[model samples]
Target: MTAAEGQSGTTGAREDERPALLRMRAITKTFPGVRALENVDLDVRPGEIHAVCGENGAGKSTLMKVVSGVHPHGSYEGEMLFDGEPVAFRDIRASERRGVVIIHQELALVPYLSLAENIFLGNENSHRGVISWNETMRRAGELLRRVGLPDPPRTRVADIGVGRQQLVEIAKALSKHVRLLVLDEPTAALNDEDSRNLLELIKQLRDEGITCILISHKLNEIRRVADRVTVLRDGRTIETLTVRENPGDEPQLSEERIIRGMVGRDLDQRFPSRSRYEGADAGELALRVTGWTVRHPIDQQRRVVEDASLTVRRGEIVGLAGLMGAGRTELAMSLFGRSYGRYEAGSVHVSGEEVTTRTVTDAVSHGIAYVTEDRKTYGLNLIDSINRNVSLPSLSSLARRGVVDAHAERRVAERFRASMNIKAPTVAEHVGRLSGGNQQKVVLSKWIHADPQILILDEPTRGIDVGAKFEIYTVIDQLAARGKAVLFISSELPELLGMCDRIYTMAAGRVTGEIDRADATQESLMRRMTVDRS
Candidate 1:
C-alpha cells in the first residue's frame, strides 16, 4: 500500500499498541466433500486496507463469510474478536448491526428501484409505514458523494452502468457506519478509468479511517493499494506480505514474484510463441464486416455499433481495442450473426460468401463463434457438468435420432479437455469447482470444439490469473497457426499490443483508426481512443 511508510515487519504485522478492530484466529471450516478452511487467520486494523489474494476456490470468500457472520458462530470453529471483544454473529444482519458490512462479488441491488430506495431498502428511514423521502434522499446523496458516484439519488438503478452501481455498494457500506468493510472483486466489472477512480476512492476512505478487507484476483491492483496482502492457496493461508510501494525494497511486487507466490511455481514463459503471418496464406480473408451498423431494439435512437468495418483472415489475429462501453463487445456480438442488437445496416461475408446473421444458430451454422465475457451468467451453466457446457453449441453432433448420445458427448468433452489443457479431475466434474482461468478455457473449448472458421473473443482473459492467461493465449495462438480468423477484444492495451497482428481503435460505437502491431504503442492507442471526447 502506497498510503505511507510504516515500521517494517515481513509476514503480516500487528501493532503492539492495541488489539486490531477485527481479528479471526485459527479459523477452521469444512463443507461437504471439501475442507474449505484449515486454521486460517486474518486481521484488519482500524483503518488499514488488508487485501486477500488467491486463485478461485482458495477459500477467500468462505473466510469472509466467516468474518461477516454469514457462517454464523457455532457452525465454524473459530474465535472472532471485534473491538477488543469476542462477538459471535448468527446472521448478516447480526454483523451489520454491529458495524460490519460485506459487499459481495455478485452485487445485490434492486434493478427496478431508484438509487435512494436501493440504498436504504430493508432499513428505510420511515416512521409508522411512512417513508421520509427528503431525509432518505439527503442521506443517500451524502453517501454517494463520499464514494465518488456522480449520480442523483432519484436515478433508477437499472438506468446506470455497473461502474456506478459499484460506487453505490461502497455508499451502502458507508451508510451502515461500518467499522470494517469487506469488498469481494469490486473492480472486476469496471473499465480502466473507472477502476482507477474506484481505487482512489478506496484510498480516500482509508484516509478517513474505515477499515477495508478486500478480495481481488487483480494482483496489480493489490500491489497498488493494499497496505498488507495475504495469499491463500488450497484453502489455507500461505503467506501475508507487508506490501510497500518503495522501489528500493528487496521484494518488488513484479508480475513474476506475485505469480510465484500465488501458484508456487516459476511462470517465466507467460505467453506461447506464434508463427509470423505471411501476406497471402496467413492474412487471407476469412471474415469481412462492411458498413455494419446496429441500434438498440427498444431504444431505436441508441446506436450501439455504428458504421464499423473490420476484417480478420486466416492465421491472423485482429484485436479490437477500446474502453468499456466503446461498443467493442456490442460490435463483436452483433457480428456473430447479429445476436447482440438490431442490425440496421451491414453485410457479413465469410470467405467471399455472404454469411447469415439473423440468429445465434445461423451464426454457428455459418462457421462463426462468440465467447461472451461473463462465464457464470452467459458462458457456462454452473450447476451442470463440464461435459454439458462444452457440448452446448454443437449438441446435434452428439445426438442420435433426437436422443443425446452420452458416450459421444463424453468423448467430445475429453477431446477438448486435452486440446485446451483444461485442468479438471474428470469430464463429469462440475464447472463451479474449477478456477477462473480453467472455466474461461472451458468456455473457449466449448466454442472451438464446434469448429468455427472465425472466432470472436470478448474480454477473453478478464478475471483469470496470470498462469491461466498464459494457457489461454497459447491456445489462441495455436488456433491462429492452424488457420482460423480471430477477432480479439481486451481492455488491457499491453495484452492486445503483444498478441495481435493488427488493431482497430474504437470510440463511441465507431472505429476511429487502425494500427499495425509494430506501430501500436499504448500512448498511440489511447490518443486514438480519446481524440475528440475531451
Candidate 2:
C-alpha cells in the first residue's frame, strides 16, 4: 500500500480502544519486494507492559518500526494516535521528541566509546555543539543507576560482556525521557540470570508509569512481565489476551495455548526430532579441537573461549549448552575457520591430522560447515535469490573456470530445497522475501550443499514456531543418521538433553563440566554454570 492509502486505512482503528493512551489503526507497510505489515491494529494503556508475540517473521518488528517513525509518517499506511491525538512521526528523532524510544536486539552501541558517550552519542545535550563531558557523565551514571546497573559511566562498552552491554542500552533509553518504549527481542540473547535482571528492569519501568511495547520470541518472559499480550501472525492481529486476568486461577500459560493462538491450530510437536543420536564408539573423529584458548579482541586480557577441547565423531551428535555468551557461538565460529576473533592458541584436527585454520577457505577445505545464530546478518545473503544463497558455500565446485555454473547451482539448490523443505515461491525467489523459518531452512540447505563431514549449528530453532522447530530437529537427526558428525549449540537445556548423545558446559571461557544424555538434568547444568560465580 502507498502512504496515501495507508492514511485512508487508519480510520476506525482507534475508536474501540479509546480512553486508551495510544491507539494504532490499520497499520500496513510494504518493502521493495515484501508486504511486511497488513491492516494491523494495536492499543496501549499508560502503565502496562503490552507484549507483541509472534514467530520471527510474524510482522512484529515491521509493525514496531512503522509506529516508531523508522518507516516515517508518509511511508506506511496507518494512523497513530498518541494521548488521544493523531500524530505523524517524520523520523526517529521526531518520535523521540514525543518521548518514544526503541532499543533493538542488536544494540546500537559504539564499542570503542565509554557508556556516557554512547548514552548521548547523536542526541547530545549541548549548546551550539559545544559539549559538556562532566555533565553527560553525571547524567549517564544516574541513568545507569536507575536501571540498577550501579556502574561507573566511564566504563567502555567493549570492556563489559553482552549482558552488561544490554544494561547500557536500557540506560540509553531511559536517558531520552521516554514515555513509550519499544524493545525487540530484548532478552533473546541473554542467559537466565541476565534475563531475569532485564525483566525486572522492565517491570520497574512499568511501575514508573512508562508505556512499554515489548516484541519478543520468548513467551516465558512475556508471561512474567506483561499484564496484557498481543499475538500477531501473517501480518495481522491475533486477538489480544489479558494473560494475568485469564490465567489468574492458573499458574502459567501453557505452550499449547500460545501455539494455538499463534498458528490458529493445535501443534503436537514442540521440539520435534525424528530420531535420537546413537552411534558406535569406535567411529573416527571427523573434527577435533584441542587446548583451544581464544581471547577477546578488544579486552585481550579477558578470554571468551577458554582452554576448551571437544570432538565430533563420525555419525554422532554433540551438544554444547551454556547461558547466552558462555562461548557457545565462539567455539563454533572459531573452530569453523576462526571467523570470530583474534586467536591466542588452538589446534584443529580433521581426520586425525592437525591443520591450520587461518582463513575461511582453509576451514572449508577441511570438511567443516558452520550455520551462524544470526541468520539475517551472517548466515545468508538476504538480497540474493534462494538458489544463490544455497549455492554460495559450494559455488567453486559448481563452477566451470571461475564462472558460476547456473544450471548446476539450480540443481543443487533445488535438491536441498526439497530435502530441507524450504518454503518459497521458486528457487529464483530472493531470500529476503521468505519468512524467518523458511529463511533459516535455506541456511540449512546452504550448509548441507557444502557436504561437510561435520556440521555445527548455533541456535538453530530460535524464534521459530513449534511446528518448524520439529522440522529442523529432524534434519539434524538425519545428518547424524547419514554418518555425518553434528555439533549442536542451544540455550534450551531440554533440547540438548533430548537430542544429544553427550553435552558439554562452558563458563568464563572454559569447559567447566560435561554430562551424558542419560545422566544430565537442568539442575546439573545450572550448578555447573554457577560453580565459579563467586
Off by over 4 Å in 2: 1-18, 148-152, 155-163, 246-252, 274-283, 299-302, 341-346, 414-438
TM-score of 2: 0.88
RMSD of 1: 3.5
Error of 1 at 269 (Å): 3.8
Q: In model 2, which range of ten residues has the least summed lDDT?
A: 1-10
Model-by-model lDDT, in order? 0.82, 0.79
Candidate 1 residues lying further than 4 Å off, grouped into runs, are 1-14, 245-252, 276-281, 415-426
For all predicted structures, in order, the TM-scores are 0.90, 0.88
Please give the lDDT score at residue 158 for candidate 1.
77
Give the per-residue lDDT digits (tens) of candidate 1, residues 123-197: 899999999999999999998887777789999887776667877887877777787889998887787788898
- lDDT per residue as tens, model 2, 1-534: 222112211224443543677789989888765677888888887778888877666788888877788889989897899888999999999888888899876668998999999999987878888888888988998888876676689988876656677788888888888999999877766667777888888888888889899987676777788767777887888767665532223324555566677777877765545453456533688888988988777677878898789887887788888876678888788887788777989798988999988777888888888888888778988899999998888888999999999999998888878887776657999997777788999999888878998889988887665567777888888888877888899887778887888888887677778888789998998777656732
Candidate maximizing lDDT: 1
